[model samples]
Target chain A: MSRGTLALCAAGLLAAILYPLVVRGLAGAGVGVSANYLINVGMLVFFVAFIGQSWNIAGGFAGQTSFGHVVFFGTGAYCSTILHVTHGWNPWLAWPVATAAGALVGWAIGALAFRAGLKGSYFALITLAFAEVFRILANSVEFTRGGLGMLIKADQRPENFQFRDPMWIYYLALALCVVSLAIAWQLTRGRFGARLVAIRENEDAARALGIDVYTEKVKVLALSGAMCAAGGTFYAQKYLYIDPSIAFGVDKSVEMLLVSMVGGAGTVFGPLVGSLVLTAINEGTRSLASVVPALKNVQPLSLIVYGAMLILIVARLPDGLMGLFGRRKSGKRHDA
Target chain B: MLEVRGLSKAFGGLKAVDDATLDVRQGEIVALIGPNGAGKTTLFAAIAGFHTPDAGRVTLEGHDITGLAPHRICAAGMVRTFQITQPFAKIDVRENVMVGAWLRTGERAEAMRRAEAVARQVGMGDQLDQLGADLTVAGRKRLELARALATGPKLLLLDEVMAGLNPTEIAEIVDVIRAIRDSGVTILLIEHVMQAVTSLAEQVYVLNQGRMISHGTPAEIAADPAVVEAYLGHGAAARLARGAAHA
Candidate 1:
């Protein structure tokens, strides 16, 4: 590994270890509800980072933009919620089933799209359409209880994936974020990773060089879907409620894109960095609204800031926030 | 050994390659030459599995490989370089070659060693760390060859590898091609450089209007009246015949 990657990993590890302790310390120091609020924000950051990293496998590393990753997230959320609510199954045990369903769906999508030779914007649009379709199904399905959504009654039990304290949820999100980062790290280093980047660089050249482009793409998409679905389960467990609109909405897809792009696509730590920045901005805006009464009625303040940030990131730092750091002397070539 | 039989491809109403047949014997350097729009590249594309021929079959060592994927064709020990060099521009030269080397070995270190050796063989030893986008035209051409060579192909199809090079660079590439042939890889190259064709190709084939006009030794090809007409006008063909006789 390069020194830069090593440093990033070390920093990530330290933050993961220190985060829970800091939250607990604040609670002990009588910060009370504010400390819990901070824990909630931290958990959101970790969740966004996890989802962003999951999206990175296909979007950043493999150069296949998917505007419908929310399908995996929703599938996972619904799979676990329905199983737990309808069958009284343990949420912890149902988590893996949810993840597997996500992988299967992802594989099916990959096989169909790749076999049909879909790529680039067409691929993106198809995935988005699938998400929309899933959202509609979740809304109307009799078993899913339609638009009313599924709700799991909160109980103070680890087996149920429920806890009265927010720390357990925060820790779970943090652990998943680290795992996602580790997966991304391994991918960018090995032969499989190199082939993915090659495909991203030039699909024709990569094929001519003996790389099986279709299989590699399908594999990455499956892995990415599985990872994102796992995050969906965590979200459902923590929130105890999931509606189709909340789980499979286009807004969720855009958030994943924004997080990874803002951090740095294709870079190992890009998603984590992007998640941190975006989460801070979001929470900061909410605090600003609370402090200034005039901003309360305006609404869309966070959306405006997010739009401006995206413009700046796209226009100035095309490589994401990481591009502002040491400018590596690698060539940049975009085929599209 | 490679054999292409009755390969035909059409784009819309235009026949890009029409029932073309060719062969490359083991350890020999064969040249395919033609005027612009003669379908030399289209033929290469069909054989290399980039384009599925509307009608025909291709075989490597007698294994029928028609309509196979390009990567599968490559895995069968046949690889082709592009006329317009396409390198992974963001990656350094070694990594670009390593992408090909990874076909044979899974280990990064092993791929790196193979890539280094091929880069050195292609006279790009000193430019291992140079980004593909930063290379000169000649350097890019060498990188293209190096990448193909790293794949350990038994039959390498080179498309316009000698184009856009100075005489010195062209001569260097010719030497590299000879060395590649001597190392037991068969070469079927597409070239417009007549000099390189004469110096390097053991046998030469001429294409015109999607048809194989003639095939023979370089000297015979240079002296063929039909070949002369295909290149020069009717008046120049007679002049070339007289000039060939005088020589």
Candidate 2:
């Protein structure tokens, strides 16, 4: 890794370690800070970063844009939730099952899509369609409890992957975010990573150079799916709820794309940077409604602001925040 | 060694390559020459397994490799370069070559060493860190050749490697091609540059409208009446014959 990337990673690590302490210190003081609010924001940032980093494996490095990543996310959420609630399995023990389920689905998608020669927007649409199908199935399925959503009882047990304090959840998310970042870092450094970038740049030339494009793509997709599913398990444990709309919604897929793209899609640190920026924007806009009485009635004003910011970022800084730092010297052809 | 037999490819009603047959021995530079849209690239695609032939067989070192994937064909020791250079525009020159080198070895250090050596072999040693999009047209062509060479192919198919190069650049690439052939890599090149064909190729095959019109030594191909009538036109052939008579 370059000095810049190393420095970024170190800084991120320091911040993650210090974050809970800072929040606790403020709560101890007379700052009127809620531990729950701080934990909520931290969890959101970490989970978004994690899922975005997961999507980056295939979308950024391999240059395969998938609009249905929520399929894997939902798979993880459903698998872990179902196993834990129905089978009385420990959530920690069910984690791998969720990840495996995500990987299997990812492999199947890759096999079918690649064999059919789907690419570009066609691939994106097919993935999106699959997510929609899964969403509807989850809604209608008896095991999933239909559209009512499934909820885990409030059990503050370590073995259950649950905690009495939201701080524990925050710490868990932080650790997972760091691990995902490390994986992304390792991926971009090796031969496998080089092959992914090659396929991204030009599939035909990559194939001519003896890279198995399909296998490499499928491998990355499976890894990506597993990672995203792992994040989904974290989400289910943190929120204690899993619904079709919450787990497999198109909005969740869009959020992953936005986080990755807005931060710098291909870079390891891009998603984290994007997640922080986006969360800050979301929080900032929500606070605006209280400050401005005219905006108090507009519940989705934050979303409108979020959408506008995305457009502006996409148009002006196509490589995202990393481009502003000149870390994207290789150019923006693979930014998609 | 490579052999293409009765290769036929069609796009809807149009036969892009029709019954095209050719051969490249183990240690000679062979040239495939044709005018625009003569299916030279299509034929290369078939041999390289980018396009499945409607009817034919491709063999490498006597092993049947017909209808295989391009990567599989490459693994069988036949590698091809594109007519329009397709560089990994987002990667540096070294990594682009490294992708090909990784074909032979999974180790990063080994691939890096191989990539560097191949880059130097193709006269791109000085531009290892340059991005693919930043290279000049001639530089991109060299990168393409360097990438292919890094794959350690027994048979190399070069498609219009000298197309956009100036005479000086062409001469430089011709020297590289000769060096590669001297190193025991058989070359089957599709070239429009007559000087490159005449100087580099031990034998030449002429193609027109997806069919092999003639195959012979450069002098014999230059004097062939059918090649003259089909590709060179009567005017250029007469001029060529006059020049030949004087020489």
The two-chain DockQ for each candidate, comma-separated, is 0.58, 0.61
Quality of model 1 by C-alpha lDDT = 0.90
* TM per prediction: 0.95, 0.95
Residue A279 of model 2, lDDT score: 92
Kindly give the stretch of ten consecutive residues in candidate 1 chain A with the minimal lDDT sum.
Answer: A327-336
- Fnat per candidate, as a fraction, reads 0.78, 0.85
Candidate 1 TM-score over all chains jointly = 0.95
> Would you list the clashing residue pairs of candidate 1?
none
Clashes of each: 0, 0
lDDT by residue for model 2 (A26-122), tens:
9889699886788789888998999999998889888899999999999999999999998899999999999999999999999899888898899
Position B126, candidate 2: lDDT: 89
Cα distance off (Å), candidate 1, residue A196? 1.1
